[model samples]
Target: MENIGVRAKELNETIVTLRRELHAHPELEHDLPFTESVVVRELAKLGLDELKPGLGQGHGVIATLRGKKPGKVLALRADMDALPIREETGLSFASTNGNMHACGHDAHIAMLLVAAKLLADAREELAGTVRFIFQPSEETVDGALSMIASGALENPAVDEIVGLHTGNLWEGLTPGQIGWKAGPMMASTSTLTIVFEGKGGHGATPHLTVDPIVIAAETISQLQTLVAREVSPFEPAVVTIGKISGGSAHNVIAGTCELRGMIRAFNQETDAFLKRRIRATAEGVAASMRGRATVMFSGDLAAVVNDKACALKMRDIAANALGEEWVKELALPSSGAEDFAYYLAKAPGAFFYHCSTFESSEGGAECNYPHHNSKFDVNESVLWTGAAAMAAYALHWQDRN
Candidate 1:
């Protein structure tokens, strides 16, 4: 484990090259043929024990490595989907396929690949099994669930799992810093859609028509109170109305108004309470205004609660791989959501963030843009830290068991 830093340094350039290649040819969710091919080709070179391609749709790749002695199985996951954002980074390898790796999944794939190579080379010293999972459609938050349904965590049966995100989502963390939290690393996400139906009439004849717009406005206003009045002060929750559509013409009162929003919470009770309150408030407001309303919920992702022991082990592993100064405990959980939560529900695991922003002469503003932005990019020099951390964790986890 002590040599992990040196090994990561040796593979840094190759990891960066692979990351750039993936960035230039970005692909979106579940439909990554070329990206899958590149990953498969690189993994094949490592001479793994068994390579299983096209899991859960024809994009995910699962590679298994068996050690000389038997112990326990460890799973390492890396997402491989790009965002729909157009590239604005202006880098030579910037994506041109009308999509970009704005969230640094490209770097995740490269780091995991290099980690696999490092582990495969040291197979003789290994103990149990290592499962390398390259998942697709992580942006949509269904890839992990699909992979689980397809038995990505079975066969050898994963004892513990580790995943990392390469980005500057955690504020104040430099490029080499690793952010870890013991519990509730990320929030759950739920989509709430409400439709208000009312009578349509000329705008001038306000008395004859029941305006759904007014009802929608009232509903939106009341929905904000769910977090403030209903949820406990200690709990963290966010209700955001991202889209609203109602009238087509200024002079006409529309018959139907649509409201779409998202709810984020750290626990199931809070999520359920928010959903219930949203439906009741929207429907009640519409009914009182002589209008009808329908509420629909979809795309639910659970919160990522890290196992206490796993999180501590990951912190120690990261500290060993990259100096202790590079590891930092996150003060709070992030409101952002990830599909990796699905995997954690099935196995004891930990998900962490790797600060990918490095100080450059260009300026900090350009290098530290938030994820999902068109200009999002990572400092390639620190890519090895993630690889080394994952490799060290897997090797040490086997020895621990």
Candidate 2:
């Protein structure tokens, strides 16, 4: 057996080069021109002629590496778009503009590109076909659906799909360490926008004016109770108001206030129930204060549920290939939502995580920053481990066929 780990060091320089280049030119969601060009150029260098670029419009690319024998098809995905955050890591390759790849999408893209190269090199020995997908807009507009709609999922008819995200959730873990959970791995998300309307009046008005700001505040306060008073405490859920806008000055009583947030849940019933309660609470709170409230469920994403049998098989593959210590059994489900849920919704697959191993003593090592922070940065050494884990899983799945 040709060990995938042994091939890691040989590809380190190329991986670093690719990661740095992408980092320097980060693109926002649904608009990844330079990133796509880089992917096309690299795939061309690997001599994979069956290239299918523009799979999801801006920055998605799909390339198929043929194997020695026909068998089940496997699809691997990596998101290409960066966030609107400005760079603060101060690296030599820090983003040139306001947008940044602060969520480690650079690493994800680089690892998947390296996997394509490695798989291409081993094509003669492989048994099943491997389809490489470079996805776009994962940070924004549900890029997975766009890719699937563009026929990225079907041409090869993948029996199983796999992808990895980098995170700093665990301490003392090695770079490239893999985490897996069956059932609900990530929560479903529903965006809510609530607008409250009241009569505009002077701040000095004694008792004649209905204050929308007060109503908005009351509504925000009452919205918190929906999860606590209505939903089961044992069933974890969250409703967070991410953005609120209303008054422009302190001396004027604002006539309108807008609250934007999302509701997150692990189950369908809980998710639906929360939305119902939120709407009811918003309207009730507004009406009690003689104001009007409008609530809308703007958009949503389903929870990511890993196929139990596939997760178990990948765990065994990781234990065999990367050692027992590399494979972790995750107990708590992730509260954050993933559009990878869209892919899992259509086919059986698993979305895994690789630890971004930033040292705890480092000044910027606060795990509190989370994934979307503009200041967020991840340890880069996990690139090789992530590539190897995906490659190992693909090979093992082929064996099962």
Distance from true position, residue 216, model 2, in Å?
1.7
Error of 2 at 76 (Å): 0.4
Clashing pairs in 2: none
Task: Give the per-residue lDDT of model 1 (tens digit) for 168-210.
Answer: 8777787868888899999999998999999999999989999
TM-scores for candidates 1 onward, in order: 0.97, 0.92
Q: Model 2 off-target regions past 4 Å?
A: 169-172, 248-251, 360-370
- Model 2: per-residue Cα lDDT at residue 385: 74
Q: Global lDDT of each model?
A: 0.91, 0.82
Q: What is the lDDT of residue 228 in candidate 1?
A: 91
TM-score of candidate 2 relative to the true fold:
0.92
lDDT of 2 by residue, 37-73 (tens): 9999989988873788877865688888778877888
Alpha carbon deviation, residue 103, candidate 2 (Å): 0.7
